[model samples]
Target: MKLLSRLVIGLVVLIVLAYAAAVGYMYFNQRALQYDPQGPITTLAETTLSGAENVAIPVDGSVVNGWYQAPAPGKPIIVYYKGNSGSFSAEHERYQQFVADGFGFVAFDYRGFPASPGSISQQGILDDAVAVFDWAAQKGFPLVIWGRSIGSGPSTYVASVRDAKALLLETPFLSAVTVAGERYPYLPVALVMQDQFPVNQWILDVAEPVLIAHGTADTVIEVTNGERLYQLVPNKDELWIVPGGNHGDLWARGIWRQAEPFFERAVATP
Candidate 1:
């Protein structure tokens, strides 16, 4: 009986040690648990286009930084919410492509990244996106929201709450909690995660046209997450699956070729 009691006690001690390790890990890597921003790229805000103008807009009690390029007088404006890593300056090529395609573009950095001030959080980012959209509307420009990877959270959230011409999501995950759960199945992510960024829940309420692109070779968030999001949207939506294309390279693989047609069609409708 004593031997059996000792074995039970040992098991309890082991479980306690494992739990302590998990807590410690979660504390140290909380930023990773939230949004892990890589080291600031030196080329983050450098503009390559001849006519591109750098601009700043206020968001959530802070000045959000971005670049603006006008392609035409009456073209729809594309407000791009970029990924977590790089600043808006690094996305000039994308803006140039859109400008060449006859669309005006605005790409902005979130708070606490580069020139933007204030702390970063899920709700803060969403509020910043809304402020940007409001700024665009005030300028009398129609808006098309583009979200990539982590940017999908605020973009989709704003799209659901506001009126937008269309939405483009690239390599988006369902939610931060879901992704964390998948990555760390042993952790109770639902309870531990501070910023949930629930895109799956918000997409269901978004009525505007949605274009989702995912690459089969994506290892970070997996293509299944994009598929799941596409399936959840209740309104007009299209999912473009790129064979062997990985995350952050959907456009490089000609996925944008398929996407541009859909974008044109959506813009032409009504």
Candidate 2:
């Protein structure tokens, strides 16, 4: 009986220590764990959109800012959702490509990322996307939602909920839990993750034309995730697997050359 009692005490102590460590880690690294929407985003928003005007849309009681480059009056407006890091500054060149393609382009930084003020969360990002979409609709512009990396989650969610003309995902993951599992297989991510972006579930509900692109050599979030996501969509969606491309270098490596044609075809249809 004494041996069993000692065993029980040891197990209880171990559990307590584990729980405390998890809590401590979450507390101290909360900012990093969550999104830090500072620095580069501000500089990106301030710069002109090359050929279009810069605009700000209010979201979550704060101004969610962006750049608007008008191509033709009646052309479709491309609303871009960037990756987790950096702001519009880092993404200006990419935005210019869409504008030069004769599409009105609007790309913005999420809250806590530069000019915007607010904490970031999975749902918060979706809400912000919706707000931007509404703003575009009000401006009499047709909307195409484009998401890259982490931004894919909100873009997919918004596309599922709204009348998006088309959906574009670049280097997207299947879900947050799937990504966390890949990075930390030991942790119970399914239960611990507070911001779960289940793109697999949401993609099923999206009725618009969808285009998913991923680099074949992507190391950060593998191409498999994007493939899995593309496979899950009920509609016949387009998937582009770039040869010898890394996560962020898809555009730099000329993936856009193929993408621009795909976008032209997709946007032209309806």
Best by TM-score: 1
Q: Considering only N, C-alpha and C atoms within 3 Å, which residue pairs clash in candidate 1?
A: none
Position 224, candidate 1: lDDT = 92
Q: Write the per-residue lDDT of candidate 2 for residues 1-270, one digit (tens) a residue.
A: 999999999999999899779866755664577564656444543545546665779876778877876657657888788888867657777777777667787788777677567777776788888888888877676778788899889899888888877888999999877887787676666766788789999999999888888998998888899999999877656888888889888888776776666656666776
lDDT of 1 by residue, 1-270 (tens): 999999999999999999989877896777665665544643434545667776789865568877776647656888889888857666677777888888888888888676577778777788888988888777676778889999999899989989888898989999978888888788777886778899999998888899899999998888999998898987756888889989878878876686567667767777
Off by over 4 Å in 1: 1-4, 41-46
RMSD of each predicted structure: 2.1, 3.0
To one decimal, what is the Cα RMSD in angstroms of model 1 from the true structure? 2.1
lDDT (C-alpha, whole model) for all candidates: 0.81, 0.79
Highest-scoring model, lDDT: 1
How many pairs in model 2 have backbone atoms within 3 A of each other, for residues 3 or more apart or on separate chains, i.e. clashes?
6
Clashes in predicted model 1: 0
